[model samples]
Target chain A: MLKRTPLHDWHVAHGARMVEFAGWEMPVQYTSVVEEHNAVRTAVGLFDVSHMGEIRVRGRGALPLLQHLVTNDVSRLSPARALYTPMCREDGGTLDDLLIYHLGEDDYLAVVNAANTERDLAWFRAHAEGAGDVDVLDETDRWALFAVQGPRAEEVLQPLVEADLKRLRYYHCIPGTSLAGVSGAIVARTGYTGEDGFECYLPAGAVHEAWEAVWGRVQALNGRLCGLGARDTLRLEAALPLYGHELTETINPLEARLGAFVKLEKGPFIGREALAAAKAEGPRRRLCGLRLLERGIPRAGYAVHRASAGGPDGSWEAEPCGYVTSGTFAPYLHQPIALALVGGGAAPGERMAVDIRGRLVPAEVVPLPFYKRGAAAPGS
Target chain B: MEFPQDLKYTEEHEWVRASRDLAVVGITDYAQSELGDVVYVELPAVGARVKKGASFGVVESVKSVSDLFAPVSGEVVRVNGALADHPEKVNEDPYGEGWMIEIRMDDPSELEDLLSAAEYAARVE
Candidate 1:
């Protein structure tokens, strides 16, 4: 049976096309993805991200337990600050990528992917066995998340919430009473779209009211209700890695070019030993951005190839180098772009070919983030 | 919403407009709206023989890919190659400019089994 969020009726009422995503019935789009994507890029957009898992870890050992499970050093996070980190297995493969919010001295919340909730909680429980007073609770069903993202996101959200959103820096969050009447929603001044935005975590029952309030405010500012399709495109434009596509069980954090999150010097995490070794000896395959040289858009699972040596039969026949992990027609860049996992030789400016529908489309290895809007950067 | 009573439809959301032994095949307006923006369309080659209820081609949007099923067993007389360059026409006008293929119907009587516009709309709901 498919689960439904509190705003499922709201989505249906708003003409949202609903689909089963991660066991929950969610809206894939309200309008066109291109229009919604452009809305978030240029104006403002809201997303129903209630499907994402919110796991709370609290007690005296919550800090140490989180530090041990994730690649990032959680010790550095001051109260109400958040850190984007990758949770790895004992073999250094990524279990999932999550955002760790240090809510208080003994409280921390890990927002993980919906599909990986059970696996992540299992990992935490197993690893955090000996840790002091640690409690890992899956609070996914208890809350509803809404993301207001874009340049004018703050302007739309500020009127409804009492929190001083301007004072809340990027990656910082605060607990506040909802103006929509949900008392204890956590408003985080962080977003995946690489735009100025806020992610609100409110009580599940009160989500409809909160959504109505936010939507009204957004409509007043000419904001849009975006869907998962636009959410994926916007994040891809920002070069933010999707958990399953960019960072998977088969992919290491270092190879995904997220080494900044991996603190090898930090003591005794689940994948600490293997990660340390990977850091010492560089990764075999590295993820890089690709800009298509031809008309075709490069898509995920398309083989990356280089021209083979020798005669026309071999020379003209491209040799498979790697594969594209994610690709999209970047609305912001107005060009086809992709994230490819290629060999070490595939450096920036290097030429390659992406196999699209049995044809090799020429592409160039480009720098990460095919489009960057304003001053937003990774970890900013 | 704008179901032309003259047209016949399949459970798979394909619309068929028959003219003697020649039939025009396209997706319904409901299918187009559900699929969102159609980015690329793969059509069966001209002269290719297709079977009723078989996969004939694919229609890809920005979000998902859907198979185009043949409503009647026939030989492909012509394909709308214009869709290769401009697939969004399907979303704009699925029954008109978005007609996927023209088929030389193998059995014109098969159209009798298909649902009329009202029946198809009822089935979808």
Candidate 2:
């Protein structure tokens, strides 16, 4: 059976194109992808992220239990601060990438990918067995997540939220607040899009009316009601890694270029030893950015080969060097961009070609993040 | 979705206009709206012969790809050059500026196989 978020009916009623994504019937687009993509780049956009899974760890030992599961050091995280971390397997392979929010003294919430919720919970239960006094609960059903993103996101959200949003720095959050008359909402200054935004976590039932209040304000500014299509494009343009694409059971954080979040020296975690060994030995494959020089959209699982000396339809036996993990014709950048897991030798500025089905289209290895928004101006 | 009564539509959601032996082909507004934003369009080269009900081209959006089937047997007289850079025209003005190809149809009678605007609308609805 397919799952539907609390906002599913609202999205359908508003002319959103619904598609099955990650076992959920989610809205892929409300309008055209370009319009929603451009809206986030120039103005503001609202997104229903209620499909994301939220797990609660409530106990005195909540911090230590999390410290043992993820690669990042949980000791550095204080109340109301959220840090992105990659949970790994015993062999240093990635299990999932998620956000850990320190809600208060003895409560923590781990927001994980919707598709991996079941597996992640099993992993958590297996590890938490007699480890501490922590009690793990899958709290996904109790919360609804909404993200207001883009430059004008603060302005669009200011009227509805009672908290001072400006004081909420990037990567920080404020819980136990009221927004649109709903209490216990957690307003976090984090987003997958490369834009200034707020992710609000509220009670599931209250989100329906809260969405109306927030959407009404954004609509007055010509903001968009974005969906999974724009969400994927926006994250791609920012080089944000998707779990199945960038991180898998066989892909480690170091290989995926997520080593900065892994605190190896912060004491032993699940995969610290293997990760440290891998770090010393170097990864066999590295994830890098690719820009198609030819007219081809690189899709996942497309073979990446060394550029051939012959013309478009070359007879040369292409050496499979890598494969694309995620690719799209980025609406914001107006070009085809991709993230590929290539051989360890592949570096930026090198020439490569993507075997887009049968035709090998020339491409260039570029730096991560195809786009980033400009810095905010002085106090305006 | 707006289905112009003057144009002919296919069960596959394409729209066609006939002028003697020549036919102008484009996807209906329903088709383009369903496809979302068209980022790339793959069309058969000019002077190519396309059979009715056969796959003639490909339309790619940000989410998925769909094959463009020929509404009628015809020789491809011209392909839409504007689509190479501005494929979003299929979304912006699917009926007018978004016309994809002009075909010297091999059999004008093949137009009878396509659906009328009202029929196509009912089928989509």
Candidate 3:
């Protein structure tokens, strides 16, 4: 049986195509995937991300426990700031990549991937290491997360929320705010779509009113009731990593191109030593962007190889250099783009090809972010 | 979008408009809508031979990819050139402007195996 969000019935009523994702029956799209994707790029969109897991760690030892678990430096985060980090096993394999929100000196919330909720919680419990001051609570069922993302996110959220939308900086959150007449909501200026947006976390019981209110303004602006499909495209265009595909249990942070988030010198963490050793050795196979220069779209698990014409059956005889982690015809770029784990001397501008189905389609390695925004507003 | 009674369809959702030995082929409206926005399409060459029920092409959206099956066994005589530049035509009008290919039928008897519009509607519904 699939789990249903509070918005499941609403999504179905609005013509959303629902699909089972990560054990939840979530909306994949409404009218179409491309329409929802483009709406987020050019205008605005609302996402019912209620399936994401929320785990709370509060106590005097919260800071120490967080410091020992994640790859990034958690001590640097002041209250209201959010830190993005990779929580890893002792051997440097990623457990999950999550955003840690500092609510107070002793209160912190780690928002994790929905599919990894149980495993991540178990991992946290296993690593508690007799920290009696820290108390970990699974608070996922208590909140509904709605991400109002895109260029006009501020305009759409300002009227509905009590807090000053413009005052919130990127990666900061304001607790004790009221949203759409629902009090005790947490409005955070954070999103995965690489847009100026806000994610609202309110009581699940009061979420329907907020969603309806947000949907009203969104419809007036010709915005979209988006789903996981648009969310994937938006993140792909921005070169953001998804957990299962980009940062997996075997892929270290360095290999996944998350070097910026790893604080190797930050004392002792569960995976710090292994991460440092891997960093010193240099990543052998790196995750990089690939643009299809010829026809055919690259799909996940497709073999990527150095260009060769030796094969007889109209395919490459060369062994695969690597494989694609994620690929799509980017709706924003209007071109086929992919992110691949490439090695064996494959670098940007080096010739390569993705074995799409049975045919060898030419491609070239490129820089990350198939699309880039022009400018960002202050504190937005 | 209406499925015309003049065309025949496959369980895989491709539609064929047969006229003697030559016929035009495209996906049904249900197929295109299910596919979402068409970002890219990969089709067989003009001279390529295709067997019924075999995958002759690929249709890609921003989210996923679906294989395009040949509705009838034939040799491809013409291919849709517009799809290279404007693949969204498939979603815009799967019947009229989005026709994928025209083939010289090698076995007209295979047409009898296709589903009628009513049958196709029932299957889709």
Candidate 4:
């Protein structure tokens, strides 16, 4: 049976075209992806992200257990602070990428991908065997997640929560009561889109009322109701990695260009050996951004080829350099951009080809993010 | 909702305007609204023979890709080339400037199988 969020009926009433995604019925779009994408980039947009899995780890050994299990250091996180990290296997392969929130001295909430909830839980259970004083509990069914993202997200959300939204630093979170009467909720200043935003995790029963209340506030502030389609495009433009595409069981966190999150010097960890070896030997492939030089857009799984550097007769020679993992016609850049796993030598400014519809389309390697941050000027 | 009484529609949301031996094809307003903003269109070349109910083109929106099926068997005589650059025309004027293709009908009697405006609207609802 497919699971439904507390706000499922609300989405239906709002005319959302629902589709089965990650074993749950979710809205793919409300109006248009371009419009919603622009809304989040220019103003503010609300999203129902209740499908994400939230797991709570509690006990005295929670911090040490988490530090040993994930790639990031849990000791660095204070109360109400969050860190984005990838949980990897002993072989340095990413099991799941998630955000770890330090709620208190003995309590931490780990938000993981909905599809990987079971796997992540099993992984955590297996690793927590010898670690006494740690108990991992899946709290997904108990919580409803909502995100308000973009320039004016704070303004739209400030009136709904009692917490001082302006004083909250990025990646910090606090427990508060929703204006709609949802209590004991965690409101975190973090988001997938490269915008100033907050993600609220509220009680399941109060989710519907909170969603309506937040929606009313955002609508009053001229924010929009965005869906998964625009969510994907916006994150792609920001160069954020998605699981099962940019992240995989075979793809290590370091090779995914997320070394900043991997704390190798913190102490001994599960994947530290393999990660250190990889660091010493160097990665065979690197993830980079690709900008389409031609009119066609490159899609995921499309072959990326490097034109021959030296050959006689001036004949064009090609070799499979890599493949595109995530791609889209960037609405913000007004051009097609992609994230490709290419060879070491295929650095930025290099020329490449993406095979689309049996035709080789020219593309150029560019920097990680196709779009850059400017002033936080909200649109009226 | 504003389907012209003179036009005919199919269950697949395709609208057909029969003018004797020629037929102008487009999607219903419901289809355009459901598709949202169109970004690209891949139409068959002129003179290409198309079978009834066969895919003759594809329309890509920001979210999904939808196949455009031929409502009746005919030879493609013309296409709306303006959609290549301005695919939003499909969203702006689905029945007029947004017409997908014009076909020289091989069997004009096939129009009898399509639903009238009222019938089509009721079926969609």
Candidate 5:
């Protein structure tokens, strides 16, 4: 049986198409993918990201335990600040990417991908066995996460949140605040949509009431009730890496272009030696963006080949240089775009061909993100 | 989903409208709703030969790609050129402007193999 979130019934009532994702029955789209995608890009959108897992680490040994577990410097996180980092195995491959929030001294919350919750929790517990005063607790069922994103996100959330939304900076959080009538909610100024937004972490039982309070304001702004489909596309346009697609067990942070988040200078961590060696050796394959020059929708697992020539009539090289990690018809760009991990000196401005099914669709290797809001979109 | 009474349907979720030996084809409303927002549609070129129960084109949505199976063997007389630029027509008007191709049938009696509107609706339900 698939696990259901607190808002599962609400999603069904709102005409959302439900799909089983990562062992949870979640809404893939509330209306249509394009409409929801456009809503987040143009205005504001709300998402029930309750499927995301949360783990709480508390006690005197919390900081030391976290420092050893993740690649980023946990000590750099001040009070009410969130740090994005990738947790890796001893082999330097990504275990899961996490967002650790320092609620207070010795109190932290690490948000992980839904599918990796149990594994991450087990890993944390195993590491904390010898570490003193560290309490690793699985809080996945204790919280319900709601993400309100886009340019008008503040306008919709400001009136409901007691904390000053304007005062919250990026990658910061306000803990123990009343949000949408739910007291003690965590309002974090962080999101996956690459927009100015807040992630409201409410008590699991209070989510229904909180959702009702926020939805009214959301509707006033013509905001949409987005789902996982829109969430995936929004993150893709932002060039954010998804756990399974971009950062797998075999794919390290360096190859995934998330080297900035991995702090090797912070001293010894789980994958420090391997990661440092991998860095010195350089990346085996680098993640890059691809935009189709022809009319074709590139899908995941599609073969990416070097183009012999530049036009639609050009032929593809026999050997595939890479494979698409995530690809879709990017709604905001109104074009088919993809993120691929390629080797053999592929860079921006080089021509490539994506074997979409059997057809060699002409494409070009572009910059990372396919769309950016205020700035000019690359490869447009 | 609207299943036009005048059209015959296939289990693959395609609809065919027969006019003498020429047949107009497109995906049904049910198919469009199931696929979500249509982004691209690849149709066979004009004068292309298609076989019954074989894939004749491709329809891509934001999250998935589906094959448009031929309901009857025929020679394609015309193809929808507008879909190259405006694929949303498949979701907006699956039975009307979204018509994919006009096929000159090799055997008009093949329409007997398709389900009626009521049968199609029952099958989908």
Candidate 6:
């Protein structure tokens, strides 16, 4: 049986195409994926992200436990700031990448991927045993998370929020605020879409009313009721890593191009020794962006190759070098783009090919992000 | 999802419009709407041989890809080249400009095996 969010019925009523994702019945899109994706790029977009898991850790040991479990320096986090980091196993393999929000002194909330909820909770419990004075509790069902993202996100949400939206800096939060008449909501200036946005965590029981109120303004601005499809495209365009695709149990932070979030110098963590050694040796396969030079959309698991000269009949052939991790035809760029784990020192501007259904399509190694906000729009 | 009375439909959600031995092929409205926004299409080369119930091409939407099947066995006389640059035509006008191929059917009588508009509509419903 698939789990359903509180907005499942609402999504169905609004003509959303529901699909099973991560063992949950989630909305994939409404009218069209491209339209929803473009809406977030040009205007405001609302997302029902209640399926994400939130685990709470409180007490004096919270800071120490967090610093030991995650790759980032959690001691730097304050009540007003949030941190992003990747938790790993003993051998430097990624467990999951999550955002840690400091709800209070010695109290923190770690938002994790829905699919990894059970495993992550268990990992936390096992580590917290005999660590110190700490209490780890699963708070996944306590909140309904909504992401209001885009250039006009603030304007769309400011009217219903009590706190000053502009005052909340990026990666900062106001733990207790009123949103759409709901008190004790957490409004944080953070998002995965690479947009100026806010993520509001409303009490689960009162979420419907709050969502309805905020959605009214969102609809007034012609913003989109985005789903997981648009969310995936938006994050991909911004070069944000998806756990299963870009970061996995076998894919280390360094190989996934997330070294900035991994603090090797930080005193001993679970995977500290392995991570430090891997860092010194340098990653064997580096994740990089690939843009198709010819027609053909690359998909995950497709073999990436070092392009060779065409055959006599102009047939394409190449030697395998890597494989694509995540790819799609970018709506904003109007071109096919992908992230590939390339080996043997593949550099930007090097010619490559993606083997698509027995055909080798030409491509080029490019920079990470396929799109960035504030940059000139395509065809401008 | 409109199933034109003049066209024959297949269980695979493809439609065929035949005039004598030559047939025009395109996916049904139900198929295109289910697939969502079309981004790319792969079509068979002109003069390629296609067999009934065989996969001939590919139509890729933003989120997924679907195979285009042959409704009837024939030789591909032409393909809609415009879809190479404007794949959205498949969603905008699947019956008109979005038609995928023109096939010279080897057995014109095979059209009798296809479902009528009413039958196709009922099957989808």
**Per-model TM-score (chain A alone):** 0.95, 0.95, 0.95, 0.95, 0.96, 0.97
Ranking by DockQ: 5, 6, 3, 2, 4, 1
Docking class for model 1 is acceptable
lDDT score, candidate 6, position A145: 92
> What's the CA error at residue A74 for candidate 4, in Å?
1.5
Per-residue lDDT over B1-125 for candidate 4, one digit per residue giving the tens place of the 0 to 100 score: 57888898988899998898999999989998888877777788999999889988887776666889899998999999998778889998999999999999998999999999999999877
Candidate 5, residue A94: lDDT: 97
**Candidate 3 per-residue lDDT over residues A1-380, each given as its tens digit:** 99888888999999999999999999999987777877887789999999999999999988999999999999999998898999998899999999999988799999999999999898887777597789888999998999999888899989987678788999999877899899978899999897888899989989999999999988888899999998998899898999999889899989989999999888999888888988888887889899999877888899998776665787645567899999998876777888998774356787788998877788988877777764332233
Estimate candidate 3's alpha-carbon lDDT, on a 0 to 1 scale: 0.89
Off by over 4 Å in 5: A309-319, A375-380
Task: Mark the regions of model 6 whose C-alpha exceeds 4 Å error after superposition.
Answer: A308-317
Model 5 over residues A1-380: C-alpha lDDT tens digits?
99999999999999999999999999999889889988988889999999999999999999999999999999999999999999999999999999999999899999999999999999999999989999999999999999999899999999987777888999999988888778979999999988889999999999998898888888999999999999999999889999999999999999999999889999899999999999999988989999999999988899998876435766446468999999999888888899999885478998888998788888988887777765543355
Alpha-carbon lDDT, every model: 0.87, 0.90, 0.89, 0.87, 0.92, 0.91
What are the fnat scores of the candidates, in the order listed? 0.31, 0.62, 0.94, 0.50, 1.00, 0.81
Clashes of 4: 0
Q: What is the Cα-based lDDT of residue B60 in candidate 3?
A: 84
lDDT of 6 by residue, B1-125 (tens): 68899999999999999999999999999999989889999999999999999999999988888999999999999999999999999999999999999999999999999999999999988
Q: Assess every candidate by TM-score.
A: 0.89, 0.93, 0.95, 0.91, 0.97, 0.97
lDDT, model 2, position A343: 83
Q: List model 4 lDDT by residue over A187-291, tens digit each.
A: 999998888898999998878777888898889878899888888998998899999989999999888999999999999998999999998988878898999
Candidate 2, residues A1-380, lDDT tens digits: the string is: 89888999999999998988878889999878888988988899999989899999989888888999999998899999999999999999999999999999989999999999999999998888997789999989899999999999999889888778899999999888888888889999999989999999999988887889999989998899999889999999899899999999999999899989999999989999999999999998899999999786888899998764666675544578989999999887888999999886577888888987578888889987788786332232
- Candidate 5: residue pairs that collide: none
Off by over 4 Å in 2: A308-318, A375-380
Shift of residue A79 alpha carbon in model 6, Å: 1.0
